[model samples]
Target: MSIPLDIAALGERAAAMIEELGAISQSPDTLTRFFLTPEHRRAADLVGRWMREAGLDVTEDALGTVRGHWHPAGEEAPRLLIGSHIDTVAEAGKYDGCMGVILAILALEAVTRVGLSRPYGIDVLAFGDEEGTRFPTTLSASAAVAGIFSPANLTMRDADGISYRDALIAYGKNPDDIPAAAYDPDKVIAYVEAHIEQGPVLEAENEPLGVVTAIAGASRLSVTVTGEAGHAGTVPMRMRHDALLGAAEMALAVERIAKADRHGMVATVGRMHIDPGSVNVIPSRVVFTVDLRSGSDTSRRDALTRFEREAHRIAAQRQLSVVISAFHEVATVPCYPDLQLRLRRSITDVDRRAVAMPSGAGHDGQAMSKLCPIGMLFVRCRGGISHNPAEFAAPLDMGLAAAALVRFIERFNLPHLENNTTGAET
Candidate 1:
């Protein structure tokens, strides 16, 4: 017998929990909970308590990942994994990572309340770090669970000079036991994540929920534009080889190349630094950062090539020297087609206006994919605003999303669905 689902009440409760989780932050004014900090510990405790209340066994791993298990009795059965990161970026909105974690727990609770017996158990995971705000590396906790966290990251130190290994020890975690946190691929059937869209797509379509087709691959680069500094008043407009002006031109070119492709390719120059802090001095150098991402790697790389070409062309036109370097990047990740079908059906069950789109932002799903096939459901968030205090998700939208998750889980174990998995071919 399926217990009646009160989506409105569930949404209200989820909204309240999201607000409460945001409150367990390092700062009172903003949500900035990082990996293994005091605030993180408190957040873990609260989440653990919620898991216990939901009738699941809970434990915190060495790397600070909190897991709640709804272990099935009798024979060993495949497990369905649902999760998202608990850590937040600086001044983040309450809904980004934290909302997924809360929603996963609620989904499990709803399943249990319905008393549906299945061959697969359910586990809710809350990863320790996803933002890379405290350290230079991202997805440490999820990578550890995926059995791919590099040991070299342990020696990498933070701004306060605390190595990851040392930080683990300080947090009562044994670095040597990091490998034990990994989940066996054979034991897991699929991984599902319910997250806020963090973009304007769903809102633009006037929908409450959507299914993710893929998570975009990203390329990160640093560029330096160099020119001669001169007296601002004495230098003629044409005589000035201002690096700042060149950088501005290059930035605009980036937007042009990305939007010109017009297939969800995105390029952003988020950071820029100017040399010589004098109001009357012409800038000699400008350092800028580029973050380019797209569902299609070919489009992304082509845009990057054009970006660098345009940057150099602009620099030469202004008689400035330009240097471009690629630093970090990840390959484009595809959503499991089988799981996406289920997610799509689940959304249709809840709301008929469902759209399929690729995520512009990288997520924990990228790492978890190494362990098992992953799928995602994105609830609409207001203004596509995320990583900021202004981020907001309506309670009604969350209600529909919660119902969709419940629908997905209820139909996940159908034998026909298992007999024809697209994951093996992929």
Candidate 2:
């Protein structure tokens, strides 16, 4: 991927930034940066320094999202938002959420160096908490910027019983000041995120980049199965009401139904626990977590209803009681047609093999949809692996992504930029 002589330096810079941020993890053994922790704050500070070096003024919000502002002609043109989260899932890879921010910086840096005159400005945002590993709420940082931050979210707690409000204060910011983070949407065009594919589709198709059609919505469930505990020797197999058995039946049913759906539905039972662990004792209780996602909200909800109904039936047949609770549900965000067309053109200019695909993963764009149009570009990742130590994206792919982004920026346009400022930003 031989790029233009002047902007080619950005590709190497993107790879180096990924490595630098990967080393700033909480654990010395694996990369594990979380929200509002010391590591996250440190990452914000580093991002500010890099933003300054790129000739952009910097700011940090109450949620610790780092903002780098760039003006092509030192005028207040419509702002073009480009960035991803710096926070990571447990044992996360280098490029899951962080790559978008770094690659944005690199692309904007090239624009800054070349003094390209444009009608829109560029803002590189390093969002603070997209992974939701510690806070249990994803896209909270970008939601704040979009002016959609819910007051109820502050009441949420972490695994260690820390409230998000308290965590905000401990992170050295005023929880009451989140409203100040809101930006004027009329001053912007749209939001764009460059990220790793985080799936095998691009590799399977032998393409380096894909323009996202839409991001899937998610519904999270916690299920419990309860039954009587008894001595294994005293209770015959036919007489025992085993909760674990019922749970196993329900889990298999979830897989079977999800595989039957045609709209790319994916259901996962990622976490589970079985009680009464003694080898001689019949299992008394079981708890498991379900994560269901798809491109259509109706389809996702229908799948959920079917799974829950079948789980209850299985529990009744096994003489066990079942309970299910939904803790979170985020709506799907479709890519606005204007931005999608522009992104498709950008991808075509960079590589003729680019295609359009749906993202099964949720992103900050889901939260930012309330503010403006959103588009995304995905670089191929090794084996479609993410949120792990083994996840990786090639430097050549980063270059390819940078080229696409540069093309997108050069063709940047919105109704507001051509005439009056558009409303409904924050």
Which candidate achieves the best lDDT against the true structure? 1
lDDT per residue for candidate 2 within 1-426, as digits (tens), equals 222533345567788998998899999999999999999988998889888988889989989999999877455777888989999988889999888988887777767777777766788899988988897678899999998898888999999999999999999999989999987877767888988989999999999899887788789999999998999899999998999899999999999888988767788999999897778888899999999987767788889999989999999899899999998787777776678788888888877767788799988888777777788899999999988888988887888788788888877754442211122111
Indicate which candidate wins on TM-score: 1
Candidates in order have lDDT scores of 0.85, 0.84
Model 1 C-alpha lDDT per residue in residues 71-190, reported as the tens digit of each score = 654236777889898898888899998888888888888887667787778889999889888888899999988878999989988889899889889889999999899888777777
Q: Residue 15 of model 2: what lDDT?
A: 85
Stretches of candidate 1 off by over 4 Å are: 1-3, 73-75, 231-236, 414-426
Candidate 2 collision pairs: 185-425
- Cα lDDT of candidate 2 equals 0.84
